[model samples]
Target: MVASVEEVSSSLVREYLSRKGLKRTIACMDEEHPRTEASINNRSQLRETLHIEDLYRKNKVDKSPFKTLLEIIVKHHIEQFVSLEPNDTKADEITSAVVCGKQSKIRPETEEECPSQPSYRSLMCEQDGLSSHDHIASANDSDCQKSQPLIPFLENNVSFGQRKPDINTMKPEDTQRSRSNRIRRGMMAGPVPQESTKKRQSRRAEVSQPLLSKEEENKQAQERLLFTGIHKKNLERSLTGISIADCGGGKPSGRVQSENSNGKVEQNMQKTRNVKTEPNLSDLNVSELVLDDIDDDDLREFSKVSLQRTVAKCQYTGRPMDKQTATELKAVLLGSSLNYFSVEWRNQSFTFSEIPELSYGIVQRKGGPCGVLASIQAFVLKKLLFENTEISYTGLQRLRPSNATRRQCLVLAMAEILWRAGEEKQATVAIKSGKSHFTPSDHFRSEEVLEKIMCFTVDNLKDLQFILEQHIEQFDSGMLGCILLTISAVLSRSVEKVREDMDVPSTTLIGAHGYCTQELVNLLLCGRAASNVFDNDMELDSGNGNMMLLKGIKSHCDVGLLSLFEHYNICKVGAYLKTPSYPIWVVCSESHFSVLFGLQRELLTNEDKGLEFDLYYYDGLANQQEEIRLTISIGNLSQSFQEVDTDLIPPLELCIRTRWKDAFVSWNDTEPLL
Candidate 1:
């Protein structure tokens, strides 16, 4: 290996990160490279890891063959190394490194997975999923130079020049018997590329290079076909337990299989299937699709695997936040966060700010972090809705207490948004020892709990739950102060009381749901929990008598849900929820909550018949996946490529329409995503 292995490996990892669209990770690596924990030390290992050895040789970059194995070790983490048995011979120690970024451990396979011929072939077959029969049949094919009884247990000590002659006369049985000793010859070296009298041995050897290229291309094409889209992503997780890093194992660096190996393939498949593993991240399109089934262990694995390779930044400072320093976020930080992202349309593109602080605090999906999610939406919207610069990252970082960290700043933001979202927006409101009083929010109905901001004080973190139980009896069980970063709420009420007030049957309230619903959202916004999405107040039977439901939001709101307006089709909804004071609205499609915001504020006021305004999508459940920035152009001109409205509308488009009615969204060059 060259002395500059770290430099070279760093460059290769950078390229890999970029190719995977990991922009933030790339930035992180640049800021902290030579400081990286692990790296591949040579060309052969690099080629094998990337499966681009042919691509490297194709462009005549480095024609070096594999002569040494990778020794990628993390700094100060030497205990992670697992060496093979000392007596097993040098071939048994030829280990491969996993390049998922943080920790690259050498996978210890069974003794049969050594680098000697047969076992090496099996290992390659395991990786590239190639079969052995292809090699067996090719033994007597025209590609072979000669045929004769071959020697069994042929030692690798054969002279380099005599090796070709010695192997040409080798028999299949002899090859198998000598598999353990044939280490120098290697697996799938393809008989050193033979030639007949139609070409001399040198010409044949030269011809083999082109054949290697063709074979590599065919393998790559097949691999691409085998692992496209979600299949490819799933393979990354299952093969290496890497969530964000590219496993680069989609196309194993080997050839295709044949009929005889079908049984071996099935045997391997059975072994793989028998390995008890967790279910994979599903391809479901529902909003809560990933979280409903996601586990805490998954979250832990997700964090460990991600932080191993990726070093995210402090969202406020843009300084490197390595995995160790990042762990603090989970223990101390609390609050909702804004996921500002950008989009493109009509060749025009825009990007919003990033909340890279999602290190240990990635969305806690099972609890439906809607309070955190919605509060952040309100925070970001308020930041843009008002002239206050305090909402900005740097501005928030410089918040009161002077020494407050980035996490505490988010908690402060959540509290501020609740206050701002209240009717009697006060400088301070705190519930004290066993005392509870309600001051109405401007929008809180006089009929229900007139109070907003069910403030409670907690001297000890352990006592937060007890304090909430004693004071705010209606506090959402799943989303408590521990998760939302505060012991206060904009409003809180029991579902039974809400249902009774809305004339809903008690039969529907039997079970505890793990997701947020319309009534809960309305309760969060207004003190009264209304069930119906109406333009104005509707008279309803409260079982006591006819009662007036407060007409939906009167004055412009800080943040709004567009699904209610879209589903009800009320013209008056446009003034309140459809268009908040700012250009952001929470979109609920397929029972998930994403936000749609635009770069320009005119998007809300523009009343043109076919008004065109750009919008962006931030998946409610994802803090890691890339958000979409849509450049919308709505006009009478329709292109032939545009599909009719009757076609299956992608869920993304439906979410967008919940915010903008009669929107004719064109994907431009992008295929419509379902």
Candidate 2:
């Protein structure tokens, strides 16, 4: 039973050793050992023991301290098994030669005859001469034997295979020197040097060596091909997935049901990471891909065309502007420093010549060309043509009867046109032919257009005033009176300085031919005239004429002249006549007599009348001699009318009184009393 147990345990150990691939040779056991009991339980216990031993071996190999030893043993076994394959003897010999040369130490030759039969070790030493400090010092010396090229027979095939040499294979100092040499070479080659012929040869030699065996190459090639094919398919699949994503695959799961209802979108996402996507350039439309190329001139032309079209549309529609059009027009008008063109339908022309002048006050008052006025005129003409049915072309022609009449007719026509155009002032001026001196119907054989003229004149106060003052004779007395009253009212309301400057009273009598009866009284009473009337006319009789003039003046004097004097606040009248010694008697009109009487009464009535008063009348009957009349009055009344002595009067007073009496008599009998 013990032997059976031993056999079973040995069987188990053999099986374990075979499975673990370990070399095993069992040792013969001693035969004098006691026999062990063998029951079913013991056999089971042996099995259990064997299992435990196997577990212990595995633990020692896989974990901790013994694992390194296990790996070394495994590696040794693999190397031995692999080395059983046949290899080339020539290759082996060459490899041994190279290794032997690398390990050998050879001394440098002396300066005599070179050493015969140079050893492979000497060749290796020469090839690796950079290791010596002396070789570095003699680097520039071409004559040095150490400078000779080494490995002349070996092809320039120094290949750096993927299975690089382990650092442990070389001495640490040698490895450091090799790295320094590599760094020095790199430094010598600057950034962009041409590849030397030696480098090309080395690269060719490296590629020529078959680092990968045929089987391995084939296997790797197949793998690469498969990977490439899979990659392409994956790329296509990813592209399809991208398209799906674009078409709602990336939407909430609730929005889209998947075709394969695995309920695990996360898995699909994981698969997606393994794929690549390529953009489909062909899918883009040609038109969408190409952008239009525009030039500066083209853009400018487009803008011009668009503006012109918009303007044309606006003109054609005749509808009130919508917000957009109005806004555009406003922007254009404000933004641009140019005038826009407008069509004059009546004129049948397009022009920018009539842009409105943005200004205040009377149109054309300044001497510049009147753009606003011209525009208004053109507008009026258009309105006339369209609205006034009675004004045909022939009628229009009749309206302008002659070249001289043309201005008047045109003004009338303009006025009418303006009236129709809703310009009341201009329209009224147009219809009043006489008022504007237009005589519109007179040119066409129409009757005295007085009513229309008056209407026009009345409507335009400024024009009427201008006409009345400028062409005074053209207006009737009634019209002139009306104009004067209007002017007076205007003056009263106007600036005081202007009224004073104009001197309305003087202006009113500016062109009067002669002083009328009433004007004479006003002049005297209001103190508006210069003193002493003198005339050069000497032909007329003075006695009756002078007496008649005095009576006429007395009759005209009434309370009106006195009231005028009071209103003007005339304190006193400077004496033109004085009294004393001589009585200068003269014949004169009754008007002159009346004037003298009034003067005598005023002087005598004054309590402060310091100077005595006298009147003299002269009739220019003789050429040299003068006739004079004098009267003296005192107190508030002239009680005693007596002739003063000639010698008593001052000479100047006598001369003045005599001359005035003669002048008054001559003026009274004139053709028309002024």
Top model number, lDDT: 1
**Predicted candidate 2 versus true structure: per-residue lDDT over 1-674, tens digit per residue:** 24365655444443333234332121111112211223111323544544454544554575462322224345555555557535654444344455545422232344333322224434443454333322322232234444433443332323343232333476879766755664444321123245665455345323432575666555544543443333433333433434333324444322231223322211011112222545443332222221122355435644554444343333211122123322232222122212222111111211111111110011121211122223222222323323335334432232111111222222332333223222133212211233223232322322222222332223343343333333332321122221222222222222232222221222321112211222222222221221222211123346766521211111111112111121123322122212211121111222121112222234323434234454432211111122133443223222231254534433333233332321112222222211
Off by over 4 Å in 2: 1-515, 524-613, 618-624, 627-674
Those runs of model 1 whose alpha carbons end farther than 4 Å from true positions after fitting are 1-409, 420-422, 425-487, 490-512, 526-528, 540-551, 564-574, 609-611, 622-624, 636-647, 658-662, 668-673
C-alpha lDDT of candidate 1 relative to the true structure: 0.40
In terms of TM-score, which candidate is strongest? Answer: 1
Candidate 1 lDDT, tens digit per residue, 1-674? 34355555675665455345465575466445532223442345556655655444534533543222221222112333344455553323343222211122243443233223333333443343222333333332332222222223232333344443344477978766555333323445344333344234223223323334555545543443443433534644543544433334343322332214212210000001223454343332222213212345546755654443322211111122122221222111111011111111011111122232121122434334443455454444444334344333332221111111223333333444444333333222223222223332333222211122233332333233333323331322222332222223322232233444343432221112334445545544443345544444656566767675543444456566666335445423445666666776667655566666665667777767678766655553554443355766545345543455634767666556555556677666555556
TM-score of 1: 0.37
How well does candidate 1 score on lDDT at residue 8?
58
Q: After superposition on all CA atoms, what RMSD does each candidate show versus the true structure? A: 26.4, 53.7
Poorest stretch of ten by lDDT in candidate 2: 353-362
Q: What TM-score would every model get versus the actual structure?
A: 0.37, 0.12
